[model samples]
Target: MEFTPVTHVLFDMDGLILNTENLYTVAFQNIVSKYGKDYTFELKLKLMGSQTHETANTIVKELDLPMTPEEFIIESKKQFELLFPDTEVLPGAKRLIEHLHNKNFPIGLATSSSEESYHLKIDKHHQALFSLFPYKTFGSSDPNVKRGKPYPDIFLVAANKFPENPKPEQCLVFEDAVNGVKAAKAAGMQVVMVPDQRLDKRMTTDATLVLNSLEDFKPEIFGLPPFDD
Candidate 1:
Protein backbone atom coordinates (compact mmCIF):
# COMPACT_ATOMS: atom_id res chain seq x y z
CA MET A 1 0.00 0.00 0.00
CA GLU A 2 1.22 3.50 -0.80
CA PHE A 3 1.33 6.10 1.98
CA THR A 4 1.38 9.86 1.79
CA PRO A 5 3.52 11.95 4.06
CA VAL A 6 1.40 13.76 6.61
CA THR A 7 2.39 17.01 8.30
CA HIS A 8 0.12 17.01 11.33
CA VAL A 9 -0.98 14.30 13.76
CA LEU A 10 -4.31 14.27 15.53
CA PHE A 11 -5.36 11.93 18.34
CA ASP A 12 -8.56 10.71 19.90
CA MET A 13 -8.23 10.64 23.66
CA ASP A 14 -10.54 8.13 25.34
CA GLY A 15 -9.85 4.62 24.10
CA LEU A 16 -6.85 5.64 22.05
CA ILE A 17 -4.33 7.37 24.27
CA LEU A 18 -5.87 6.63 27.66
CA ASN A 19 -7.26 3.52 29.36
CA THR A 20 -10.44 5.39 30.33
CA GLU A 21 -12.66 2.99 28.36
CA ASN A 22 -12.27 0.39 31.12
CA LEU A 23 -13.30 3.00 33.69
CA TYR A 24 -16.17 4.06 31.42
CA THR A 25 -17.38 0.47 31.23
CA VAL A 26 -17.33 0.21 35.01
CA ALA A 27 -19.27 3.44 35.36
CA PHE A 28 -21.83 2.58 32.70
CA GLN A 29 -22.30 -0.91 34.10
CA ASN A 30 -22.85 0.50 37.57
CA ILE A 31 -25.56 2.75 36.22
CA VAL A 32 -27.34 0.23 33.95
CA SER A 33 -27.15 -2.58 36.47
CA LYS A 34 -29.14 -0.45 38.89
CA TYR A 35 -31.95 -0.59 36.30
CA GLY A 36 -31.56 -4.40 35.89
CA LYS A 37 -29.82 -3.95 32.53
CA ASP A 38 -26.27 -4.79 31.50
CA TYR A 39 -24.09 -2.46 29.45
CA THR A 40 -23.09 -4.64 26.53
CA PHE A 41 -20.52 -4.44 23.75
CA GLU A 42 -23.18 -3.78 21.13
CA LEU A 43 -24.15 -0.58 22.93
CA LYS A 44 -20.50 0.32 23.53
CA LEU A 45 -19.69 0.09 19.82
CA LYS A 46 -22.49 2.49 19.01
CA LEU A 47 -21.66 4.98 21.74
CA MET A 48 -17.89 5.11 21.36
CA GLY A 49 -16.58 8.51 20.18
CA SER A 50 -19.91 10.24 20.72
CA GLN A 51 -20.19 13.49 22.65
CA THR A 52 -21.35 13.52 26.31
CA HIS A 53 -24.98 14.38 25.68
CA GLU A 54 -25.18 12.06 22.69
CA THR A 55 -23.79 9.20 24.72
CA ALA A 56 -26.15 9.87 27.62
CA ASN A 57 -29.19 9.97 25.37
CA THR A 58 -28.16 6.81 23.49
CA ILE A 59 -27.60 4.91 26.75
CA VAL A 60 -30.91 6.03 28.24
CA LYS A 61 -32.82 5.12 25.10
CA GLU A 62 -30.99 1.91 24.23
CA LEU A 63 -31.27 0.47 27.76
CA ASP A 64 -34.84 1.72 28.23
CA LEU A 65 -33.66 3.38 31.42
CA PRO A 66 -36.06 5.44 33.47
CA MET A 67 -33.72 8.42 33.85
CA THR A 68 -33.47 11.36 31.50
CA PRO A 69 -30.22 12.20 29.79
CA GLU A 70 -29.61 14.97 32.32
CA GLU A 71 -29.98 12.64 35.25
CA PHE A 72 -27.80 10.04 33.61
CA ILE A 73 -25.08 12.58 33.11
CA ILE A 74 -25.26 13.61 36.75
CA GLU A 75 -25.01 10.03 37.98
CA SER A 76 -22.30 9.11 35.50
CA LYS A 77 -20.29 12.16 36.49
CA LYS A 78 -20.29 10.87 40.04
CA GLN A 79 -18.94 7.49 38.97
CA PHE A 80 -16.42 9.14 36.70
CA GLU A 81 -15.15 11.33 39.50
CA LEU A 82 -14.53 8.24 41.55
CA LEU A 83 -13.05 6.09 38.79
CA PHE A 84 -11.45 8.45 36.25
CA PRO A 85 -8.90 9.79 38.69
CA ASP A 86 -7.18 6.47 38.13
CA THR A 87 -7.02 6.75 34.34
CA GLU A 88 -3.86 5.16 32.93
CA VAL A 89 -1.94 6.05 29.80
CA LEU A 90 -2.09 3.24 27.28
CA PRO A 91 0.93 1.34 25.93
CA GLY A 92 3.22 3.17 23.48
CA ALA A 93 1.16 6.35 23.82
CA LYS A 94 3.82 8.33 25.62
CA ARG A 95 6.75 6.94 23.69
CA LEU A 96 5.10 7.71 20.36
CA ILE A 97 3.95 11.17 21.42
CA GLU A 98 7.42 11.96 22.74
CA HIS A 99 9.04 10.67 19.61
CA LEU A 100 6.84 12.82 17.41
CA HIS A 101 7.18 15.84 19.66
CA ASN A 102 10.95 15.48 19.74
CA LYS A 103 10.90 15.30 15.96
CA ASN A 104 8.86 18.56 15.83
CA PHE A 105 5.65 17.05 14.44
CA PRO A 106 2.55 19.12 15.06
CA ILE A 107 0.30 17.02 17.29
CA GLY A 108 -3.19 17.86 18.49
CA LEU A 109 -5.97 16.13 20.43
CA ALA A 110 -9.53 15.97 19.21
CA THR A 111 -11.76 14.31 21.79
CA SER A 112 -15.45 13.72 22.28
CA SER A 113 -15.04 14.42 26.00
CA SER A 114 -16.36 17.63 27.47
CA GLU A 115 -13.89 19.99 29.07
CA GLU A 116 -15.04 18.94 32.54
CA SER A 117 -14.59 15.21 31.96
CA TYR A 118 -11.41 15.75 30.00
CA HIS A 119 -9.85 17.26 33.08
CA LEU A 120 -11.15 14.41 35.21
CA LYS A 121 -9.33 11.96 32.96
CA ILE A 122 -6.07 13.83 32.62
CA ASP A 123 -5.63 16.41 35.41
CA LYS A 124 -3.99 14.01 37.82
CA HIS A 125 -2.21 11.19 36.09
CA HIS A 126 -1.63 12.49 32.57
CA GLN A 127 -1.02 16.23 32.65
CA ALA A 128 2.50 16.01 31.28
CA LEU A 129 1.79 13.53 28.53
CA PHE A 130 -1.23 15.49 27.29
CA SER A 131 0.63 18.78 27.59
CA LEU A 132 2.62 17.65 24.57
CA PHE A 133 -0.28 18.71 22.40
CA PRO A 134 -0.17 22.40 21.63
CA TYR A 135 -3.97 22.42 21.49
CA LYS A 136 -6.90 20.10 22.21
CA THR A 137 -10.43 20.34 20.89
CA PHE A 138 -13.16 19.20 23.29
CA GLY A 139 -16.15 18.40 21.10
CA SER A 140 -18.75 18.40 23.87
CA SER A 141 -17.76 21.85 25.10
CA ASP A 142 -16.28 23.59 22.11
CA PRO A 143 -18.88 25.71 20.40
CA ASN A 144 -16.87 25.73 17.21
CA VAL A 145 -16.99 21.94 16.94
CA LYS A 146 -20.81 21.79 16.59
CA ARG A 147 -20.72 17.99 16.26
CA GLY A 148 -18.83 14.92 17.42
CA LYS A 149 -17.44 11.80 15.80
CA PRO A 150 -19.12 10.46 12.62
CA TYR A 151 -19.06 14.15 11.74
CA PRO A 152 -15.93 15.94 10.58
CA ASP A 153 -16.48 19.08 12.61
CA ILE A 154 -14.12 18.30 15.47
CA PHE A 155 -11.25 17.06 13.32
CA LEU A 156 -11.63 19.98 10.94
CA VAL A 157 -11.67 22.39 13.85
CA ALA A 158 -8.48 20.86 15.27
CA ALA A 159 -6.67 21.00 11.95
CA ASN A 160 -7.57 24.67 11.62
CA LYS A 161 -5.96 25.48 14.96
CA PHE A 162 -2.48 24.70 13.77
CA PRO A 163 -0.33 27.76 13.07
CA GLU A 164 -0.02 26.91 9.40
CA ASN A 165 -3.65 25.79 9.12
CA PRO A 166 -2.84 22.54 7.38
CA LYS A 167 -5.22 21.03 4.86
CA PRO A 168 -7.29 18.01 5.87
CA GLU A 169 -5.23 15.54 3.86
CA GLN A 170 -2.11 16.85 5.52
CA CYS A 171 -3.33 15.49 8.86
CA LEU A 172 -2.95 11.95 10.11
CA VAL A 173 -5.45 10.93 12.77
CA PHE A 174 -5.02 8.20 15.37
CA GLU A 175 -8.31 6.87 16.58
CA ASP A 176 -9.87 3.84 18.28
CA ALA A 177 -13.55 3.99 17.41
CA VAL A 178 -15.61 3.36 14.28
CA ASN A 179 -17.18 6.78 14.56
CA GLY A 180 -13.80 8.40 14.98
CA VAL A 181 -12.47 6.73 11.86
CA LYS A 182 -15.57 7.93 10.05
CA ALA A 183 -15.03 11.45 11.29
CA ALA A 184 -11.42 11.54 10.20
CA LYS A 185 -12.20 10.10 6.81
CA ALA A 186 -15.06 12.54 6.38
CA ALA A 187 -12.61 15.30 7.08
CA GLY A 188 -10.43 13.83 4.30
CA MET A 189 -7.64 12.68 6.58
CA GLN A 190 -6.01 9.30 6.85
CA VAL A 191 -6.69 7.54 10.16
CA VAL A 192 -4.91 4.77 11.98
CA MET A 193 -7.27 2.89 14.25
CA VAL A 194 -6.26 0.90 17.32
CA PRO A 195 -9.49 -0.78 18.20
CA ASP A 196 -10.71 -2.60 21.27
CA GLN A 197 -10.40 -6.38 21.13
CA ARG A 198 -14.16 -6.88 21.39
CA LEU A 199 -14.97 -4.64 18.44
CA ASP A 200 -16.03 -6.32 15.19
CA LYS A 201 -13.26 -6.47 12.62
CA ARG A 202 -15.60 -5.43 9.84
CA MET A 203 -16.32 -2.14 11.64
CA THR A 204 -12.72 -1.03 11.05
CA THR A 205 -12.96 -0.97 7.28
CA ASP A 206 -13.03 2.82 6.94
CA ALA A 207 -9.76 3.38 8.72
CA THR A 208 -6.71 3.85 6.48
CA LEU A 209 -4.95 1.35 8.70
CA VAL A 210 -5.81 -0.66 11.81
CA LEU A 211 -3.56 -1.92 14.57
CA ASN A 212 -4.07 -3.90 17.75
CA SER A 213 -2.31 -1.33 19.89
CA LEU A 214 -0.39 1.91 19.71
CA GLU A 215 2.74 -0.16 20.44
CA ASP A 216 2.36 -1.63 16.97
CA PHE A 217 2.37 1.70 15.15
CA LYS A 218 5.16 2.39 12.69
CA PRO A 219 5.51 6.15 12.17
CA GLU A 220 7.72 5.69 9.16
CA ILE A 221 4.91 3.95 7.30
CA PHE A 222 3.06 7.28 7.44
CA GLY A 223 6.20 9.20 6.45
CA LEU A 224 6.88 10.36 9.99
CA PRO A 225 10.23 10.12 11.72
CA PRO A 226 11.20 6.64 12.79
CA PHE A 227 11.73 5.90 16.47
CA ASP A 228 15.35 5.42 17.53
CA ASP A 229 15.40 2.10 19.31
Candidate 2:
Protein backbone atom coordinates (compact mmCIF):
# COMPACT_ATOMS: atom_id res chain seq x y z
CA MET A 1 0.00 0.00 0.00
CA GLU A 2 1.12 3.52 -0.68
CA PHE A 3 1.79 5.55 2.44
CA THR A 4 1.59 9.24 3.22
CA PRO A 5 4.69 11.34 3.84
CA VAL A 6 5.06 9.93 7.32
CA THR A 7 7.56 11.70 9.55
CA HIS A 8 6.99 10.19 12.98
CA VAL A 9 6.68 6.65 14.27
CA LEU A 10 5.31 5.09 17.45
CA PHE A 11 5.87 1.58 18.79
CA ASP A 12 4.09 -0.86 21.07
CA MET A 13 6.43 -2.64 23.46
CA ASP A 14 5.33 -6.00 24.82
CA GLY A 15 4.97 -8.29 21.84
CA LEU A 16 6.15 -5.80 19.27
CA ILE A 17 9.62 -4.91 20.44
CA LEU A 18 10.39 -7.51 23.09
CA ASN A 19 9.56 -11.18 23.55
CA THR A 20 7.94 -10.51 26.93
CA GLU A 21 4.53 -11.70 25.70
CA ASN A 22 5.65 -15.30 26.11
CA LEU A 23 6.79 -14.57 29.65
CA TYR A 24 3.40 -13.01 30.36
CA THR A 25 1.70 -16.09 28.97
CA VAL A 26 3.70 -18.33 31.23
CA ALA A 27 3.02 -16.11 34.25
CA PHE A 28 -0.71 -15.85 33.57
CA GLN A 29 -1.04 -19.54 32.99
CA ASN A 30 0.87 -20.37 36.14
CA ILE A 31 -1.34 -18.04 38.22
CA VAL A 32 -4.74 -18.91 36.74
CA SER A 33 -3.94 -22.58 36.63
CA LYS A 34 -3.81 -22.45 40.42
CA TYR A 35 -7.57 -21.77 40.35
CA GLY A 36 -8.08 -24.56 37.80
CA LYS A 37 -8.48 -22.00 35.02
CA ASP A 38 -6.95 -22.24 31.59
CA TYR A 39 -5.53 -19.15 29.89
CA THR A 40 -6.42 -19.55 26.24
CA PHE A 41 -5.08 -17.77 23.19
CA GLU A 42 -8.50 -16.31 22.46
CA LEU A 43 -8.56 -14.74 25.89
CA LYS A 44 -5.00 -13.52 25.45
CA LEU A 45 -6.00 -11.79 22.20
CA LYS A 46 -8.81 -10.02 23.96
CA LEU A 47 -6.45 -8.73 26.64
CA MET A 48 -3.68 -7.72 24.25
CA GLY A 49 -2.69 -4.06 24.59
CA SER A 50 -5.03 -3.63 27.55
CA GLN A 51 -4.10 -1.89 30.80
CA THR A 52 -3.05 -3.80 33.92
CA HIS A 53 -6.40 -3.41 35.70
CA GLU A 54 -8.32 -4.28 32.58
CA THR A 55 -6.21 -7.37 32.01
CA ALA A 56 -6.50 -8.48 35.62
CA ASN A 57 -10.26 -7.89 35.71
CA THR A 58 -10.78 -9.78 32.46
CA ILE A 59 -8.71 -12.70 33.70
CA VAL A 60 -10.52 -12.92 37.02
CA LYS A 61 -13.95 -12.58 35.46
CA GLU A 62 -13.47 -14.76 32.41
CA LEU A 63 -11.82 -17.58 34.28
CA ASP A 64 -14.12 -17.32 37.31
CA LEU A 65 -11.04 -17.06 39.50
CA PRO A 66 -11.26 -16.33 43.20
CA MET A 67 -8.69 -13.57 43.02
CA THR A 68 -9.44 -9.85 42.80
CA PRO A 69 -7.80 -7.52 40.29
CA GLU A 70 -5.42 -6.37 42.99
CA GLU A 71 -4.48 -9.97 43.72
CA PHE A 72 -3.85 -10.72 40.08
CA ILE A 73 -1.73 -7.60 39.74
CA ILE A 74 0.40 -8.46 42.72
CA GLU A 75 0.86 -12.05 41.66
CA SER A 76 1.62 -11.13 38.06
CA LYS A 77 4.01 -8.38 39.10
CA LYS A 78 6.04 -10.90 41.05
CA GLN A 79 6.29 -13.21 38.06
CA PHE A 80 7.07 -10.32 35.73
CA GLU A 81 10.06 -9.16 37.73
CA LEU A 82 11.38 -12.68 37.66
CA LEU A 83 10.85 -13.08 33.89
CA PHE A 84 10.69 -9.71 32.10
CA PRO A 85 14.33 -8.78 32.51
CA ASP A 86 15.33 -11.84 30.54
CA THR A 87 13.26 -11.17 27.42
CA GLU A 88 15.01 -10.94 24.09
CA VAL A 89 14.35 -8.40 21.37
CA LEU A 90 12.08 -9.90 18.78
CA PRO A 91 13.49 -10.58 15.31
CA GLY A 92 14.13 -7.42 13.26
CA ALA A 93 12.99 -5.20 16.14
CA LYS A 94 16.43 -3.96 17.10
CA ARG A 95 17.52 -3.48 13.51
CA LEU A 96 14.46 -1.46 12.59
CA ILE A 97 14.64 0.76 15.66
CA GLU A 98 18.34 1.39 15.25
CA HIS A 99 17.93 2.17 11.55
CA LEU A 100 15.15 4.69 12.14
CA HIS A 101 16.97 6.29 15.03
CA ASN A 102 20.21 6.56 13.08
CA LYS A 103 18.35 8.26 10.27
CA ASN A 104 17.10 10.86 12.76
CA PHE A 105 13.45 9.87 12.51
CA PRO A 106 11.12 11.00 15.26
CA ILE A 107 10.10 7.85 17.12
CA GLY A 108 8.43 7.11 20.44
CA LEU A 109 6.93 4.25 22.41
CA ALA A 110 3.22 3.96 23.16
CA THR A 111 2.56 1.07 25.47
CA SER A 112 -0.01 -0.07 27.99
CA SER A 113 2.88 -0.81 30.38
CA SER A 114 3.43 1.66 33.20
CA GLU A 115 6.81 3.32 33.80
CA GLU A 116 7.57 0.80 36.53
CA SER A 117 6.62 -2.07 34.30
CA TYR A 118 8.56 -0.65 31.36
CA HIS A 119 11.69 -0.43 33.44
CA LEU A 120 11.21 -3.88 34.91
CA LYS A 121 10.77 -5.33 31.45
CA ILE A 122 13.45 -3.43 29.54
CA ASP A 123 16.00 -1.54 31.62
CA LYS A 124 18.32 -4.43 32.35
CA HIS A 125 18.36 -5.75 28.80
CA HIS A 126 17.52 -2.97 26.38
CA GLN A 127 18.18 0.43 27.82
CA ALA A 128 20.15 1.54 24.78
CA LEU A 129 17.28 0.78 22.47
CA PHE A 130 14.78 2.65 24.64
CA SER A 131 17.07 5.62 25.02
CA LEU A 132 16.50 6.31 21.32
CA PHE A 133 12.90 7.23 22.03
CA PRO A 134 12.53 10.86 23.08
CA TYR A 135 8.87 10.37 23.98
CA LYS A 136 7.01 7.53 25.62
CA THR A 137 3.29 7.32 26.40
CA PHE A 138 2.80 4.72 29.11
CA GLY A 139 -0.93 4.10 29.09
CA SER A 140 -1.05 2.05 32.27
CA SER A 141 -0.14 5.10 34.36
CA ASP A 142 0.40 8.21 32.26
CA PRO A 143 -2.19 10.67 33.47
CA ASN A 144 -2.19 12.43 30.13
CA VAL A 145 -3.39 9.15 28.62
CA LYS A 146 -6.93 9.05 29.93
CA ARG A 147 -7.59 5.78 28.12
CA GLY A 148 -5.77 2.85 26.52
CA LYS A 149 -5.48 1.13 23.17
CA PRO A 150 -8.62 0.69 21.03
CA TYR A 151 -9.49 4.16 22.42
CA PRO A 152 -6.75 6.26 20.70
CA ASP A 153 -5.51 7.89 23.90
CA ILE A 154 -1.98 6.48 24.04
CA PHE A 155 -1.24 6.82 20.32
CA LEU A 156 -2.52 10.38 20.23
CA VAL A 157 -0.47 11.28 23.26
CA ALA A 158 2.66 9.81 21.67
CA ALA A 159 2.10 11.73 18.47
CA ASN A 160 1.55 14.94 20.38
CA LYS A 161 4.78 14.48 22.28
CA PHE A 162 6.91 14.95 19.18
CA PRO A 163 8.72 18.26 19.35
CA GLU A 164 6.91 19.40 16.21
CA ASN A 165 3.57 17.98 17.36
CA PRO A 166 3.08 16.04 14.14
CA LYS A 167 -0.33 15.69 12.58
CA PRO A 168 -1.88 12.26 12.84
CA GLU A 169 -1.55 11.65 9.11
CA GLN A 170 2.17 12.20 9.33
CA CYS A 171 2.69 9.53 11.96
CA LEU A 172 3.07 5.77 11.57
CA VAL A 173 2.60 3.18 14.28
CA PHE A 174 4.17 -0.24 14.70
CA GLU A 175 2.00 -2.61 16.65
CA ASP A 176 1.41 -6.28 17.37
CA ALA A 177 -2.14 -6.27 18.69
CA VAL A 178 -5.60 -5.93 17.17
CA ASN A 179 -6.56 -3.26 19.67
CA GLY A 180 -3.42 -1.33 18.80
CA VAL A 181 -4.33 -1.33 15.10
CA LYS A 182 -7.78 -0.01 15.97
CA ALA A 183 -6.31 2.70 18.16
CA ALA A 184 -3.89 3.85 15.46
CA LYS A 185 -6.69 4.00 12.93
CA ALA A 186 -8.88 5.89 15.34
CA ALA A 187 -6.07 8.37 15.81
CA GLY A 188 -5.82 8.79 11.97
CA MET A 189 -2.36 7.24 11.70
CA GLN A 190 -1.02 4.49 9.48
CA VAL A 191 -0.21 1.23 11.25
CA VAL A 192 2.15 -1.61 10.41
CA MET A 193 1.14 -4.73 12.25
CA VAL A 194 3.49 -7.63 12.92
CA PRO A 195 0.98 -9.97 14.43
CA ASP A 196 1.36 -13.44 15.87
CA GLN A 197 0.85 -16.26 13.39
CA ARG A 198 -2.07 -17.51 15.45
CA LEU A 199 -3.93 -14.21 15.07
CA ASP A 200 -6.77 -14.37 12.59
CA LYS A 201 -5.92 -12.88 9.21
CA ARG A 202 -9.30 -11.17 9.04
CA MET A 203 -8.34 -9.10 12.06
CA THR A 204 -5.40 -7.61 10.16
CA THR A 205 -7.32 -5.73 7.47
CA ASP A 206 -7.16 -2.53 9.45
CA ALA A 207 -3.38 -2.35 9.26
CA THR A 208 -1.72 -0.42 6.45
CA LEU A 209 0.79 -3.27 6.21
CA VAL A 210 0.99 -6.67 7.86
CA LEU A 211 4.25 -8.56 8.04
CA ASN A 212 5.45 -11.73 9.71
CA SER A 213 8.25 -9.84 11.43
CA LEU A 214 9.99 -6.45 11.50
CA GLU A 215 12.64 -7.99 9.25
CA ASP A 216 10.10 -8.01 6.47
CA PHE A 217 9.38 -4.28 6.71
CA LYS A 218 10.14 -2.05 3.73
CA PRO A 219 10.95 1.47 4.78
CA GLU A 220 10.50 3.09 1.38
CA ILE A 221 6.97 1.77 1.14
CA PHE A 222 6.14 3.96 4.11
CA GLY A 223 8.01 7.01 2.75
CA LEU A 224 10.99 6.39 4.99
CA PRO A 225 14.59 6.00 3.95
CA PRO A 226 15.45 2.53 2.72
CA PHE A 227 17.81 0.49 4.86
CA ASP A 228 21.22 -0.04 3.32
CA ASP A 229 22.09 -3.69 3.05
Which candidate's lDDT is highest?
1
Instruction: Name the lDDT value of residue 180 in candidate 1.
Output: 95
lDDT of 2 at 202: 99
- Please give the lDDT score at residue 80 for candidate 1: 95
lDDT of 1 by residue, 1-229 (tens): 7778999999999989999988899999999999899999888888888999999999999899999999999999999999998889899899999999999999999999999999999898889988899989999999998877899999999999999999999999999999999999999999999999988799899989999989999999989999999
Candidate 2 wrongly placed segments (more than 4 Å): none
Off by over 4 Å in 1: none
Question: Tens digit of lDDT per residue, candidate 2, span 148-199?
Answer: 7798999988888888998999999999999999999999999999999999
Q: List the residue pairs that clash in candidate 2.
A: none
Candidate 1 is scored at a TM of 0.98
